[model samples]
Target: MTLTLTALTSPPARVDLSPLVPETTRGRSAIEVAGTAIRCGRDRVGVGELFAVSGYGTDELVLRGELGRIDRIGAGMRGGRLRVEGSCGDHVGARMTGGEIVIDGDAGAFAGAELRGGLVRIEGSAGASAGAGYPGTRAGMSGGEIVIAGDAGQEAGAAMRRGLVAIGGRAGDGAGLRMLAGTVIALRGVGAEAGMGNKRGSIVSGRPLRPLPGYARAVRYRPPALALQLRRLRELGLEVPDAMLTGAWTRWAGDRLELSRGEILIFDEEEVAAG
Candidate 1:
């Protein structure tokens, strides 16, 4: 049976639920799960004190309640599914090697930081540094996919080595700031300095981007590769407008101060004027 944890009340400090994943609780019973030590700010507490746990030792986990104060819901999981019924905490699926984590509501900062493999799908908006590297980390999200149905905060895919971060709505400043290599899809729009210092990644946008300093326009055409990626997004149940799926895009080679291999593809202004 799928394991379930229901929060008893709002926490005084952030509660860490990262230990409840399949790997850590593989052989643990419900009682052992209850006994699992979880951190709350500077102190440690037992899981049973804060949550009503049930059906232990399963790869599939369901968390219920307003989990915004909870942290690392699916950290370091190798496989399985984790579903959050309400708004979730930071690092929802950080460092997961494989599996899927679905957050039904908004997610906090660093939603999928340093993810290795797997998918983190948020049905609502996400906070800053959605797929970014930690303060001292070398790279962010080495591999994986993070799909947000609504807006995303600043530096959405910052310093990512490899992965896909798709934001369905507008993104904050520096959407793909300092990206190493990856694909960042900001559908509606993005704030200032969208692709600053990017090395070898792609930032795809539906709206016109503000003038980026280290960029030079390359070409304007509909890219077949982008259409394929749009199709994949549709398969994941995210909306892909017809114009977005089959529109002409203007490619700009960017971040000249860096490797200059990164590209930003904006929906062509000419195409929009013609339509």
Candidate 2:
């Protein structure tokens, strides 16, 4: 199955791609299809206006375009694979429960907002709230994995209840704000107010950061789980630096305002020197 995005004369009210029907969902064979068949902005415009679709397989869905305004490219996706050739708009994979989404370029805000299961991988930067709960909702990202290759905007994992978020680049302020449980790993430095009100989660970074006012220093140790995470990211085609995979980190516990179960792990420069 193939659909081509021709153009977007004007932004339609809403464009839902999941309802357009799919060719297949099961089987191990790679589904080599494209998103040119999906409609945009209330089906006001054809997908051909934005991209060209080719190839026909079973396990993969490839998209080629700028795709800066096409939202909900894979909403509620249950199975299979989605690969974007370029940057994408908001809600790239909103509420997806299963399958995989791979982006070769940057992603707009809410790239993986409210993701329930599966994996979303971005080779470039992402906007605010990569895996955050919706307004008034208590849970975010119950399961799944989000990998950002570049810097991220504010509140990267706000109010998250479960799952994992790994950033290969810098992260903006308010990261892990109000986190309930889960893991967030940043390869570069993170901004202020990180882990501000976290309860039962872990925020790990490769750089130093001033611990939040209420947080207390714990100890220095090398977490073994990070090794598994690095391997997973590598399998997704993300570049994980060697130093980060084999480094010691300073652990801190805090957010007394909540359960105080969450922790922030900052890499130790001295350990890196020794290695």
Candidate 3:
């Protein structure tokens, strides 16, 4: 069964829509689903007041309408699938431990912050810190994947401990700040200080990156694992250029300011992309 909710109107203030995930309303009646309460500014509003709810099922949910002011669309998701039809506000999948959240449009800041498992795929551009650690936290996106089809704002994968963050377009500055482990791939390229203080991680760039002074140019070689990874990306619907599938990548290891175990891999041939 598939549950569908269409927005009837926009909220006056940003609202927390975290409670409407598939796990919570799987078999609930339309009225029961509509009766769900969500916080809007200081007051609370029923889901029915804001959405035209219908359907009954388990494992799938479809949300429609102009949902830009809604926040935490799938925060803390444990299981099932949630689909956002259009753009959404901040924290689209914050702190989720399991399940999948697919955003057909842009997502605001912290799109998948602190994700432990599962996948958050953004079909459009993502705001700052797509998979970064939450403030005052020790790690970000401990497991899982966050894929942005368009450009990503600053600190796209800040302090990531594990998982994969793939940016199909250009990624802003500080792509992997203080990362302890994991992999970040900015296919188009990345900005300054892409891997500032990572202890152990791999930051791959399709375009040439002027390495930070702390980094030393390492041998250029063709990575045997990248082909498999790129093929997986293709299975995920990302269009991987044929040339990107096969090439010699230059590895630069650094952030000597930290453990000096992190590496930034740059493709031998420059890759071109738009903003």
Candidate 4:
């Protein structure tokens, strides 16, 4: 059974829709699902009052509307599938331990912040600090995968301890600031100051990159791990260019001010033709 929630109108204020997940509604009736309480700005309201809920739940959910201000759409989910048809507000998948969330439109800040497990796929762009830690916290997505088919805002994977963040389009400044451990793959160009103060992690870019002042060119070679990642990415339906799959990458070891174990791999398109 699939539960569908369509908003009659955009809520008057930002709404917290974290409770409307497949795990919570699995055994509930439509009426019970509607009765699920959610915070709307300073007031609390039931889903029934804001939208017409149809169908009982059984591990699948769909939310449709212009939800640019809504928050926490799938926070803390342990299992099941959730899909949003329109743009959404912040924290689209915050602290999720398991399950899958798919956003067909753009998502706001903290798109996958603090994700522990599971997969979050955003078909459109994401706002600042996507998959990053909250203020005053050193922890970001400890695990899981976030796939954004479009651009990403600043600090795309800041403070991530472990996980994979793949951005198909351009990334804003500070793309991997303070990264601890994880992998961030930028399919297109990345902005300046990427991987600043990164202690241990990998940032891979298919576009050309100027060597940052804190980094030193290591070598140009085909890393086995990178080849494996490219294959996996191709299987995931991401447009992994043919050049990247067989090309050499220029590795730069950097952030000398820190542990300097982090590395950045910039694809050398010239090598593809040379070969």
The lDDT of model 2 is 0.75
Stretches of candidate 2 off by over 4 Å are: 1-15, 20-57, 271-275
Task: Give a tens-digit lDDT track for model 1, residues 1-275.
Answer: 66788999988999888988877776667788889899998899999988888886777888897688999999888898888998988988888889999999999999998889999999999999998998887788899899999999999998999989998898899888889999999888778898899999999987886448798887888899999998888888788899888778988897898999999988856643221
Off by over 4 Å in 4: 271-275
Error of 3 at 40 (Å): 0.9
List the candidates ranked by lDDT, beginning with the highest.
1, 4, 3, 2
List of clashing residue pairs for candidate 3: none
- Root mean square deviation (Cα) for candidate 4: 2.5
Residue lDDT tens for model 4, 150-234: 9999989998889988888988888788989898888896788999988898988888877467877888888889888877776
Evaluated at residue 240, the lDDT of candidate 3 is: 78
lDDT of model 1 at residue 243?
89
Q: Give a tens-digit lDDT track for model 3, residues 1-275.
A: 47888888888999899988889988788889989999998999999998998888579888889899999999989889999999999999888888999999999999999888888999999999989998888788899888889889999889899998888998899899888889888889899988988889889888887877777777678887777777777887777788878888888888889889989888857532211
Clashes found in each candidate (C-alpha, N, C closer than 3 A): 0, 20, 0, 0
Q: Model 3 segments beyond 4 Å from truth?
A: 270-275
The segments of candidate 1 whose C-alpha lies over 4 angstroms from its true place after superposition are: 269-275
Better of 1 and 2 by TM-score: 1
Q: Candidate 2, residues 40-124: lDDT per residue as tens digits?
A: 6545444444434444445566666556766777778877788878887888887888888888899888778888998999999
After aligning candidate 3 to the native by TM-score, how far in Å is the CA of 158 from where it should be? 0.4
Pick out the ten consecutive residues of candidate 4 with the lowest summed lDDT: 266-275
RMSD from true fold, candidate 3: 2.9
